[model samples]
Target chain A: MARKRGLFETFQERIGAVLPSALQEAQTRVDDRLAKIPTRLNEYGYDAFGLHPESSRRSLATSTLFYRHYFRTETFGIEKVPSGRVLLIANHAGQLPFDGMMLGVSMLLEAEPPRLVRGMGEYFIPQLPFLSWAAERGGNLVGTPENCVALLEADECVMVFPEGARGMNKTWDHRYELQRFGLGFMRLALQTETPIVPIGIVGSEEQQPGLMNLEGLAKRLGLPSLPVTATFPLLGPLGLLPLPVRYRIHFGEPLHFEGSGSEEDDVVQRKVNEVRAAIDGLLQEGREQRAGVFR
Target chain B: MEKVLITGIGSGPGRLLTERLRTRFEVLGVDRTPWEDHPAEVAVHVLDLRKKGFEDLLRTERPSHVVHMGFIRHFKGDPNRRHEINVRGTKQLLDHCHRYEVTNLVVMSSSYVYGAFPENPFYLDEDQPLSASRSYPEIRDLVEVDTMATGFLWRHPEIRTTVLRPVSVLGPNSRSMMAEYLRQERAPTVLGFDPMMQFLHEQDLTDAIAMTLEQDLAGVYNVVGAGQVPLHTAIEETGGVAWPIPEPLFRPGVRMLFGAGMAPWPPGAIDYLKYPVTLAGDALAQAIGFKALFGLEETFRSLRGRG
Candidate 1:
């Protein structure tokens, strides 16, 4: 009375038995965690500064696979981020912004109270198809002083790459080297009286190492910079996929300075230098502590 | 009792305002076309603002308050006629308002005068420049009408002239461009560009106008609904499917449809779908003591079961 089952049938039977329970377990965990969050937190569940709750939730779930499993991101000092209105000044690297995604995920998943960090995107990134809407829905606002001021006034945590596009398009030789930080973030923090939390991200520079930048072509195409990565252009869209580089994010102590947002240039620059130095030191520490790129 | 002369009573807001103000003031409604049904107490006059009858109506009615809702938007008529009816007509009306010594004047302008530029701030206050004419010439009449009103505001401070620039008035009875766009089976939207839009429900707008007349608030005020929604989301919420076309193809596509008499909007309206022209309602809320009764969801919900 023993009928031998086919290999495919056995596999299908095994998946049928396991998949629902696995999915149910995941759904329960999400529901329980979401239930614990206060209703006030859910106030921003729909749309806040172009953040679409449904789109953000879907994208976050997909990005979580990369953040938790692929990158194996280990976040440190996330608790240093204050409860209300903060400017997260982070080092920008990786021709693509996987580091920014990880930082955002860390804040949402690892922090005591999950916070959605609004990333200030490059000016041109919002011009791309599908990407722009998704970015806005995922809480990425176009980097403008007006937007920053409004977000801060709303008591939102905004992440800024003070290095701007220069850091993102840096060649492999200059990897891990901090570019000149713009004075905008400091001025915004001063204006809003929001604390600045310096963030240092490691292993992002190795994710997609840039060999050269086609500046002229990028300009013609209305892009900021078109970096020729090792795999990109040669491998097509598949080349755009980032290598699974383990990420270590360090959140430093909140830096507060006294002055109206309209401080003198030298004063702003001095404060900017202080933030850059803090980030540089953290980056150094992160690099030294890391055993390997994929660790 | 103060006699109030309201123009463009054929329009939705005008009709609603006329009905509401009739209870408080002796409402004299004037339009190029006669209203099919108007309240028995309200006196209705069929006269063009551009014609001498408008001035005669003003002189005869001798209303203490004058509300100019007669501006002919671009979509309804040819450009030259629209200019004659809107710009020249507005100039004539303003001349009469000054000549007749009307104590209060409320001119209905649109937020479109702010211009939908990529660099526009999220909430443009009343002081923002009228930049719509910079790109699209069709709306030049609206900008000019607003300019003339503002100029009249300061020149005739004794009149207490209030220019109300309301954002995209939408409701069941409204025929505004935004409303018309939403009424379409498939609203055309610029692909990859979903600008945030604010809508002032027809009732709320009438309420604001009533408040303006009652309070005699004299300044350029931006009246907007409670919240904003992106164009795509707005279409979706209104149960209309969006036909997303690439940016480069949008103008040409609109031009083709318009040429074929199939599209409701002209090609010049492409910029609006690409960038936001959202207005701040702070002045209306704080100064005029009026808040929008309808939220964004309610505004969109009102569009349900309507074409």
Candidate 2:
């Protein structure tokens, strides 16, 4: 009974089935390796969460619990993505970051077990010496033009948040709508010829909305903004706190763009428009399905 | 031709619908065969219904109008099995419906959801909450949610669905008050007091199913008998001895019997027996447009006669 399994258990079962034992051995080996390089790693990424958890297998357990507790959402078009190398692009909805984490969890929960699906993240963080070293081990990579090209070519289910820094800023309307997607994804799909999957993350904006902005405070703190939320959660004594609101990540169809051009720019741009149209369809669908995924 | 596939044909309403629907469409019946008995015209297909991949059957049948009827009874063993068949099966069915682009679905559920015993003088209906907290009710309640949600949440809204929950059926071949009367007859002796009872004839259930399927309707409904009776009367009508067993004597023994694993009432069934009470179904009567053909007396008479 599919409904009996529901979305939570079904994702757990399918995704759990996919993690290879070799990855387990590799992860174990990596854990052992990371123990030796722990001190050097913190130089790149801030927030030492006791050094990131070794296993990427936290998709099912963590994803299910996170959604159940935080984001009360409904799902649709989840069965649309056929198993294979796919890319999920969405809007990043927070000044600080949790949008990527939430969507990462959704992808894990949505995909079958041993989901080797990887996320294509910004390169800046990973290139930060040791942090970049940890990012590579922890499945974080830069979304640079060349990096994305390689990631998509490698068949990684890379997730690109086009709005990036711009979309995360506070707005009055609470629109988590995507900013103009750069030509990078369109170019990547043309280059790798892999299907581009667009995901729309709603509810993430409200989970912790930045109703007010402080630019000077941001300059002093070296942060994005002094985005005031309903609650300023204390991270550590001096660290910034975030408002805890629920979140929902919605994924859409894979806009197939494989081999649309025989290395011709005209053909590639036409294919790019088709892919854009597909992404737009998904974005519109995410908006229409607002009743379900959003509050 | 309306492609009609009904699941759980061997159980209650599924079987009732199978008999009632055989005349109208290409009826493909799904049920776990206790033993093979093909009622010509209604092609019966055996399935665990819970296990994955059974959607292949739903696909092959290519039913335009699906009547999802399969579900293990509350008395059935393994609650996981219950959730597996009812909840998962509906999900599978909904998925199949989506894949096939089938337009209509009709599912059968229980009026027992009304949270009451048959003896309760008050009427039981669709509005009453299933009081879903209890174990058995939880299974049935969740099943109802999936059933209802399948209709509500599908991506393709073209498929209209109908969910019917029939009260204790008493029509032809249905073992209504007879089972209770027989139970009260303490082997050779009979119990002194019997509870009040309400029942719906299986034939009336058949008619209601036919009517609902013919018209496209999406909602939950209650099916109950026309009249009610005390179990004492039901016992007499069924030719069983009506011996009054005092509560003081009956209560302790029954409790002890149940406490020991030897007793038959599974924990859920124990709560079932204690049905708090419920109201009559007004919504179902208006929606289906009919009256229950068999009362307690007729139900007993029909049971007295056949298989």
Candidates' lDDT values, in order? Answer: 0.82, 0.55
Q: What would you estimate as the lDDT of candidate 2?
A: 0.55
Please provide, for model 2 over B194-288, each residue's C-alpha lDDT reduced to its tens digit, 9 standing for 90 to 100: 22345567788788777877877667676666655443345555555544443455555655775664544443443333232333556767876
Native contact fraction of candidate 1?
Answer: 0.24
Chain B TM-score per candidate, please: 0.97, 0.78
DockQ of each: 0.21, 0.01
Highest TM-score scorer:
1
Q: Best candidate per DockQ, number? A: 1
lDDT value, residue B95 of candidate 1: 95
Q: After superposition, how far is residue B61 of candidate 1 from its true place, in Å?
A: 3.1
lDDT of 1 by residue, A136-166 (tens): 7677887888889988998888999988779
- Per-prediction count of colliding residue pairs? 0, 34
